[model samples]
Target: MRIIFAGTPAFAVPSLRAAHAHGEVAAVYTQPDRPAGRGRGLQASPVKLEAVARGIPVLQPESLRRRSAQQALRDLAPDLMIVVAYGLILPQAVLDIPQYGCWNVHASLLPRWRGAAPIQRAIEAGDAETGVCLMQMEAGLDTGPVLLARATPIGAGETGGQLHDRLAELGAAVLADGLGLLRAGIRPVARPQPEQGATYAHKLDKAEARLDWSQPADALARKVRAFDPWPVAEAVVAGERLRIHGAVAVEEMHGAEPGTLLRAGREGLDVACGRGVLRLRVIQREGGKAITAADFLNARRDLVRA
Candidate 1:
C-alpha cells in the first residue's frame, strides 16, 4: 500500500514510524513549522522531522480545504491515508481520494471523547479506563466508524503525561493491526456509538490551570495530575504563582478553611482544603526551579500562612 501519513505532535511519531517501516509511505503531511520557545525559532513538528530523516516526501499544507492541497494529496496515489493527531479536519473530498479511504488513530474510544484533547479530558474527568480506536474517516468530528480498538486501565494516581505515552504505544500497535486486517480482505464492522456517556474533551487552557482550593482535596489532587506537564495546576502564594506538580489527599486532616496552610513540616506542606488536607509533594515557584516540597519549605522557613 502507498500510504500518506499525517500527524504533527510527538504522540503521532510512533504510528508514522510504524507505517513507514511496515508499509509504503509515499508522502508525509504535517502542520507547518511554528515559532517555539523564548528565542522564537521556527521548529518543525516532531513527526515532520522524523519523516524527513527517513527521506520521505513532506507536505506542510496550511489548509486541506483548498483544492490545490487536496489535489496534491490525491496526486500521491495513496492506497490508504493514515492520520494521527494531524491537528486539522479532513474534508469529505479528500477522504474519498485514497482507494481504501482514510483511517484515523484516535486516542480515546469513539463517541466517548469525539473532539480534540481526548487524553487530557479523560484524565480530567477521572475516567477509570480509556483506550485507542482506529476508525474509518468521515466528514464529522471523530464521527467515523470504528475499525479496531484496544482498552487499557487508567491507574489510580496516573498523570496525563504518563497515560499519553502509554496510549501512543497502544495506538501504534492498533494502527498496525488495523492495516493488517484491511490488507487481509477483512471487512471492518462500524458500530454506532451509544447516545449516553458521551463527553467532549475540550483543549486545555491556561485559565483552567488555576487551582481552586475550595474544592475537595481529592478533586484538587486529580486536577494536579490531569494538568501536569502542561498548564500545571497553580495557585498564588504571597503574590507568587506556584505550580503544583505532585500532591495527595489527606482525608484524616480536616478543619481550617480551604487554601489555608495547616502546617509546613519536614514531611510535606499540609494545606487545608474543603474536606481534607492536600500534602504538597512537588512544586515550582514562579521564576524559580521545581523542587521537592521539603526543599521549598527549607528555603522559606516562615512561609506558613495561618
Candidate 2:
C-alpha cells in the first residue's frame, strides 16, 4: 500500500515509523517548522525530523483547504493516508483523495475525549482508564467510526507526559495491526460510539495553570500531574510565581488555612488546602531550574509560612 503519513509532534512519530515499516510510505506531511524555546529558533516538528531522517518525502503545506495544497496531495497518488496528531483539520475534499480513506490514531477512546488534549484531560478528570482508538476519518471532529481500540489503566499518579508516551507506543501497534488487516483486504467493521458520556478535551490554557488552594488537595495534585512539562501548576507565593512540578495528597488530618504553608521540613513543603494537605514534592521558581521542595525550602527560608 502506498501510504501518505501526516502528523506533527513527537507523539505522532511512532505511528509514522510503524506505517513506514509496514508498507510503502509515498510521502509524509507535517506541520512546518516554527519558532520555539528561549532563543526563538525555528524548530522542526518531531514527525518531520523522523520522516527526513528516514528519507521519506516531506511536505509541510500551511493549509490543506487551498487548491494548491489539495493538488499537491493528489499528486502523491497514495493508496491510503494515516493521520496522527496532525494539528490541522482535513477538508472533505482532501479526505476523499485517498482510495482507502484516511485513518486517524486518536489518543482517547471514541466519543469520550475527542479533542486536542485528551491525555491531559483524562488525568485531570481522574479517569481510571483511557485508551487509543483507530477511527476511520470523517468530516466531523473525531466523530469517525472506530476501527480498533486498545485500553489501558491510567495509573493513579501518572503524569501527562508519561501517559502520552505510553499511548503513542500503543497507537503505533494498533495502527500497524489495523493496516495489516487492511492489506489482507479485510475492511474492519466500524462501531458507532454511544452518544452519551461524550466530552471535549479543550486545549490547555495558561490561566488554567494557576493553582487555587481553595480546591481539594486531590484535585490540585491531579492538576499538577496533568499540566506537567507544559503550563505547570503555579501559585503566587510571597508575590512571586512558584511552579509546582510534583505533588502528593496527604491523608493525615492536620490542616491549616488554604494555601498556607502548614509545614516546611525534610518531608516536603506541606501546604494546606481546603479539604486536605498537598505536599509539594518538586518546585521551580521563576528564572530558575527545577528543584525539590526541600532544596527550594533550604534556599528560601521565608517560604516556610507562605
Candidate 3:
C-alpha cells in the first residue's frame, strides 16, 4: 500500500516510522519549521527530522485547508493516510482522498480524552489507566470511531513524560496491527464512542503550571508529575523561582502554614500544604540544572521559607 504520513511532534515520530516499515510511504506532511529556544532558530519538527533522515519526501505547508494543498495530497495517489499528533485539522476533502481512508493514532482511548494534551491531562486527572486508540478519521474533534485500542495502567508515581513515551510506543504497535488487519481485507469493527464520560484535554499552558499551595498536597504532587519536563510545577521562594520536579504527599504536619518549609534535609524537604506535607525530592533553581532537594536546600539556604 502507498501511504501518506502526517505528524509533527516527537510523539508522532514512532508511528511515522512504523508506517514506513509497514508500507511504502509516498510522502510526509508536517507543520512548517518554527522558531525555537532562546536563540529563536528555526527548527524542523521531530517527524520532519526523522523523515528527512529516511530520505522520504516532506511537505511543510502552513495549512491544508486550501484547495491547492488538498489537491497536492490527492496527487500522491496514496492508498491510506496515517495521522498521529499532526497538529492540524484535516478538512473533509482531504479525508476523502485516500483509497482506504485516514487512520489516526490518538494518545488516549476515545470519548475519554478527545483533544490535545491527552497524556498530560490523564496524569493530572489522576486516572488509574490510559491507553492508545486507532480511530477512523472524521470531521469532528476526535469523534471518529475506534477500530483498535490497547490498555496500560498508569503507575502511581508515573510522570507525564514517562507516560508519553510509553503511549507513543503503544500507539505505534497498535497502528501497525490495525494496518495489517486492513491490508488483509479484515476490517476491524469500529465502535462508536460513548456519549457519557467524555472529556476534553485542553492544550497545556505555562500559566497553569504555577503551584497553588492552597490545594491538597496529593493534588500538588500530581501537578508536579503532570507538568514534568515542560513548564514544570513552579513556586516562588524568597523571590526566586523554584521548579518542583519530584515530590510526594505525606501526612499532615502541624504548626507551619501552607507553602512554608517545615523541614529540609538529605531525605527530603517537607513543605506544608493545605492538607498534608509535600516532601520535595527533586528541584531546580531558575535556569539551573535539576538537583536533589538536599543540594538545593544546602546551596541556597534562602529558599527555605519557614
Identify the candidate with maximal lDDT: 2
For 253-281, candidate 2 gives per-residue lDDT tens digits of 65467887777766678778888888888
lDDT of each: 0.87, 0.91, 0.90
* Model 3 misplacement above 4 A: 253-255, 301-306
TM-score for all models, in order of appearance: 0.96, 0.96, 0.96
1-306: candidate 3 lDDT, tens digit per residue: 999999999999999989988899999999999999999999999999999999999999999999999989989999999999999999999999999889999999778989999999998888999999999999999999999999999999999999999999999999999888877889878898888999999999999999887788999999999999887998864456789899899987566668887877787888788889888899898779899988887886765554
| Residue 303 accuracy (lDDT) in model 1 | 74
What global local distance difference test value does model 3 have?
0.90
lDDT-wise, the better of 1 and 2 is: 2
Model 1: weakest 10-residue lDDT segment is 297-306
Which ranges of candidate 2 are over 4 A from the true structure?
252-255, 302-306
Clashing pairs in 1: none
Q: Candidate 1: how large is its RMSD?
A: 1.5
- C-alpha root-mean-square deviation, each candidate: 1.5, 1.5, 1.5
Residue 270 deviation, candidate 2, in Å? 1.5
For candidate 1, write residues 54-126 as lDDT tens digits.
Answer: 9998999899999999889878999999999999888899999999899899999877988888988888778
Order the candidate numbers by TM-score, best to worst: 3, 2, 1
